[model samples]
Target: MAQKLQTGTSKTTRYAIWAILILTVLSTVALYASMFLSQDNNYKEAKVQQDNYKKYQEATEEYNKKADKQAKELSAKYYNSFKEFRKTPSAFKASDVKELEKKDLKVGDGEEITDKTTEFYAYYIGWKPDGSVFDGSFNKDELKLPLAVKKNNRGWGVIDGWSEGIQGMKVGGVRELTIPADKAYGSNGSPNQQDSAKSIAPDTPLKFIIMLIPKFEEIPQPNYKDYGF
Candidate 1:
């Protein structure tokens, strides 16, 4: 009877050890499966985000390219119409600009610039008496985008001649201005010292052909948040 009881106790001990080993193996397998699932989910999410960003970048590039092309085409259209006025005024002399003088190149039926504070956009070419172009809105033979002159409550944000000369001119009008030294840069070459390209000699007269155009609408840049950044 004593031998039988000892054998039964040994069998129970063996069964408990096997149960513990089996439970440990199952736990290890479960842990590995959970880790692999988490890693796979993270990788998929990263891939999705990368693909979205690439699509957004491509869309933004295409949008900007179209906008740029449209802008260039518009500029060229207006530029070609007024490029003929780029020639020097007939018998133009710096001495002839004793006072602010103006000659209308083309009259427009659009809204008149009745007030000095009325802001506008224009394409212009300024030249010295020698017919050398000092500054202009042209790039080689092509015209660049129109420049905006912001409104100032005080008056026009330009030379005294422009403020007075632009009066009564309508939108889409072209005007040639012969500005005297007093109404132009005066004794100073330019108000901005860093602007060496536009600088002129003291007491020098200048001429310009101004083409007023409609306001330009700007294209907005793409937002990162819109692309699920």
Candidate 2:
């Protein structure tokens, strides 16, 4: 009877040991599963962020390209119109010699001017050959823009006709400048001037009646004079 009781106690001890081992294995498997799931979530989030960033960069590039293209087109159109206006003869004739007479204006011949750069202040009425005024900036209250001729970098500022016609005037002089269509707006009129109906066509001839106000300061002669004999 003593031996049988001893054998039963041994069997109970072995069963308890097996239960403890199984519980430890299950706990380890659960911990590993949770860690793997967390890592996967983090990887997916990082991929999404990278994709969004790429799309934003592409959109910015496209916007800049479109803006640059529009600016180039506007500049080209403006220059082309100017070229066409230069070719018309009607742009050269004075519209009002009588008005010029009332002001006691004396226009100097193209030859008497010595300074390469001519400066003047003048009121102007610009019109198409058809007697349509497209742009006129003549007003006593308005500030006149100084125009210079033959200056190395300055001559390019004025329109082609103003540069060519203004050379004859002296300081405190006034005259009407009639620019031919080829030298004026040509087929494309002033881009800023809106028609009364808001439907003016491009490349229309431009005309102007300019008065010479004062001669611009002459460009300084280089010191090459000191080197001369």
**What TM-score fits each model?**
0.61, 0.36
Q: Candidate 1, clashing residue pairs? A: none
In candidate 2, position 35 carries an lDDT of 89
What is the alpha-carbon RMSD of candidate 2 to the true structure? 18.9
TM-score of 2: 0.36
Model 2 has an lDDT value of 0.48
Please write out the lDDT profile of model 2 over residues 94-152, one tens digit for every residue: 34321211221455333333345433444345566555555543223332233333345
lDDT of candidates 1 onward, in order: 0.80, 0.48
Badly placed stretches (over 4 Å) of model 2 are 1-105, 108-115, 139-154, 193-203, 215-229
Task: For candidate 1, give the lDDT of residue 162.
Answer: 82
Quote the lDDT for 44 in model 2: 84
